[model samples]
Target: MTQNCFDDGDEDDVPEWADRVMADVAREVRRRRKEMKWSAQDLADRCEAIGFPIPRNVIANMESGRRAVLPLVEVMVLAEALYTHPIRLIYPVGYVEEVQQLPLTYPVDTAQAMSWFAGLNEDFRADHRMLRHHVAHRTAVERAFFAVHSEERQRRAAESTVDDIEQAKALRTQADLAERTARAKAELYQVRSDIYADGDPLPDLPDELVDVDPPEGYERDTD
Candidate 1:
């Protein structure tokens, strides 16, 4: 179905991939312009001179989705204008159910079409093996990407597990140190209490005590 523009009613029926595919196309087009350092007006003027006559706002709206579902021929023309491969603009990320409707020819040039069809047939038959090889190569690339991503995720999980173990060890060490501190403080308090008892030799010091003594060399060495 050729939709000039998508309406609100058709919003639900628009495949979830529509927005993403449109956005990707727009982004690539924009990126091409940026890479060439061309302003929107510059591109528009060039296209106009070449008989395409695209306006800056038209390009902007298309990219911004105010205009949606650009025709494939227009996309190819844009690719030519941008000096990029048409396939780059049309390559689908995942499964894309796309249909291109070509205008019907009346009083058709059967000879030309037949010639083109013959060439296509020859190409298919001649390059079938090479085409299969490329397809296998693409599948391998996709599988490798998946495997790399999976390995990265597994590595992160392993690192997280190690971190958790380290944190637990640190916590255990802290608890042990705290317990030792409390015990030492309690023992010192007991010593102070004993000193302050009626039959004890000296007065007890405060529970929170700071032992202050001169340097060890303060006392003469007894031989």
Candidate 2:
């Protein structure tokens, strides 16, 4: 409900209550932007589409305590485009209590918690370095980064186990073949050694020579 103060025909540079209301509205809008992940450009685009014609600088002003409330329809459009209830754009603090009541256990060390908070708004260079370290150290940040891909890793491990087993069987078969080849080679050498006799003399002739028969005719006459 916009009241027409001009009816009194008295001009005040700024109204005290209006100033406080603007401040509260600005803070709520800022908080809602953070919650909805909407950039100034996103809000501007929505306002433009809804015939509000809000410049990005005006959105920034409204979100930084520099401007009063936007028109009601503009707030509604922003809420709809951000996929949130319209009241949230005007009173984002409503969600703070719920966020505080969440079941997550805050870190015990205040310094560690502050460090994590600082990383959220870090400069681009520090952000890159922090992400690199997070991956290199396999910290919680890295785990959360890869949570979506963990199932794929498990599947790959399962397939690799099958290949590993086949490779092990192949190695064992190769070892067995090598052992059999070595034994056959050894037996061949032993047979060759027996034939050569290490340069020893050959065995004597057959003992049949000792009983050589006389002339066939003389043997028959004696009988």
Candidate 3:
């Protein structure tokens, strides 16, 4: 005799592993839905919006353990609606660690990891945007500093006064120090961008100088 949908089969009929996996999926679905404060009907609505129409009753059945077999398409659509990756629904415990361990040199691996990461944490995307902006602004400032200092150096070289020579030396020293500082910062920010914004392009920073804000009461050379 065929077992009904709600029937708990005899111990011999269903393998322990299958039961455990289904239960895990159901629990994960319920947990993520609750995290977003979405009701079963809300989830159904969202799935329908994404072109996979799951009814509210089916959602209730899945969460309540009445539904045992979850289709892959349903899992994918449900994950999309929940703003999470399908792996999170399947392997709630080890998905992040497993994805992190993948070799990122392969383009496919990198793409998959990024997609998973984006779905899991919205804040990561926001942080990446802010970091990119900071790097760009610093790069512009460093370029301006170099251009200004180079013009000043040429002007100082043309002056023959002893006072002018000493002042030129001081200016050169200051410019050298600032360049080193900016280079160090750019390198650090580049390393951070590589790790956190994997698969995204980072702003190209000027090679020569580091970025520095002018000190209070210090007048910028307008020439």
Q: Which candidate tops lDDT?
A: 3
Better of 2 and 3 by TM-score: 3
The TM-scores, one per candidate, come to 0.36, 0.32, 0.39
Instruction: Provide the lowest-lDDT 10-residue window in model 2.
Output: 98-107
For residues 87-176, what per-residue lDDT tens digits would candidate 1 score against the true structure?
A: 555442222233221222111233333334344455664666444344443443344344444545554555555577775765565555
What lDDT is reached at residue 198 by model 2?
A: 34
Query: Candidate 2: lDDT over CA atoms?
Result: 0.47
Q: Write the per-residue lDDT of candidate 2 for residues 156-214, one digit (tens) a residue.
A: 44556557777576556555554554454344333323323333222221232211112
Error of 1 at 33 (Å): 0.6
For 1-223, candidate 3 gives per-residue lDDT tens digits of 1112322334443444355456666777888899899999999999999998999999899889898688889888988999988877766654222222122121123235555544445565466665555555565556555655665564565454368778678667666755755675555545434433443433443544323222231232333
Return the lDDT, model 1, position 220.
29
| Candidate 3 accuracy as lDDT | 0.60
lDDT of each: 0.52, 0.47, 0.60
Name the runs in model 2 displaced over 4 angstroms: 1-14, 93-223
